[model samples]
Target: MKKHTFMLALTIVLSVVLGACSSNNSNNGAAIETNLTAKEMVDQMLSKVEQPSLMELDAATVEQLYHLNPELLEDYSIRMPMMNVKTNEIAVLKVKDVKDMTTVEDAIKARATDVQKQFETYLPDQYENAKNYKLIKKGNYFLFVIADPADQDKLVADFDTYFTEK
Candidate 1:
């Protein structure tokens, strides 16, 4: 009976310790520092991702991606986005300053809303994926993704991993 009680106590303590260790540090924490810029990180991430089905935007198209103040951005990438179809799209924007990231985040949100409405109107049956686009921000790094529903989580995780490792 003493051994059983001790074992249960040990298990409980282990569970608590493991749980605390695995908890998310997304809030109330500083952003991870990295040697590479956002553009380099995003480019490296694209090499890991398999998305031959989609088309990548050129520098000219990427230049026009900023609906807000384009001058604020240090660099940005917009990939695989077709105006009407439910195709894979991913973009990462690097702001010149931390404060500018919020503005860029807002612009991304507006773009998301616009894309959702457009896709909903044109492809009513498959608007769900576009509406559920993964949007994340870390420090001056802002990530916006709309990928194949089946591959969405893996793509987001891959990008997050790149940032995490930095």
Candidate 2:
């Protein structure tokens, strides 16, 4: 009776150990990385939301508004409200080098601050939208969005799917 009881206990322990090892191995899935162009990346993120009618800006205008050096980025897509009353904007950028990520992120943050200040006094409702904007960084990509709060989480989740391990 004692020997049978000990065997059952040992079998249970071994099963638990094997289960943990298999689970750990399963956790090591390959990360979802991609070499998508700027336009494609922006399109993927925007697809997750009910896109508003924002006008795309030219590279020169984007550089002027965000105070970023175009040479530092591999590619970028920027859109904004044509009129000042609405505070809707989006920018998805890919840095040429990882070392320049800080500069690019800083420029995006500065742009966000500018957006906030612009709408804070002009339109309270839009100001709230600006305040709830998302600034997301994933590997060499960066995204800044001032959109409807309802679409914020969906946008973030969709962006993350590009980087999350499968």
lDDT of 2 by residue, 1-166 (tens): 9999999999999999988855642225453456677677678877767676777878788789999988898888888877787787877788889789889989998888888898878889999999989988766778788888877777777766656454
Q: What is the C-alpha lDDT of each candidate?
A: 0.69, 0.79
How many clashing residue pairs are found in candidate 1? 0
In model 1, the Cα lDDT at residue 14 comes to 100
Error of 1 at 86 (Å): 3.2
TM-scores of all candidate predictions against the true structure: 0.68, 0.74
Q: Note the residue pairs that clash in candidate 1.
A: none
Candidate 1, residue 40: how far the Cα is off, in Å: 3.6
RMSD of 2: 10.0
lDDT string for model 1 (5-110, tens) is 9999999999999878546345336666566765666677677776644455665555465467756777777776444455467887777886676678888888
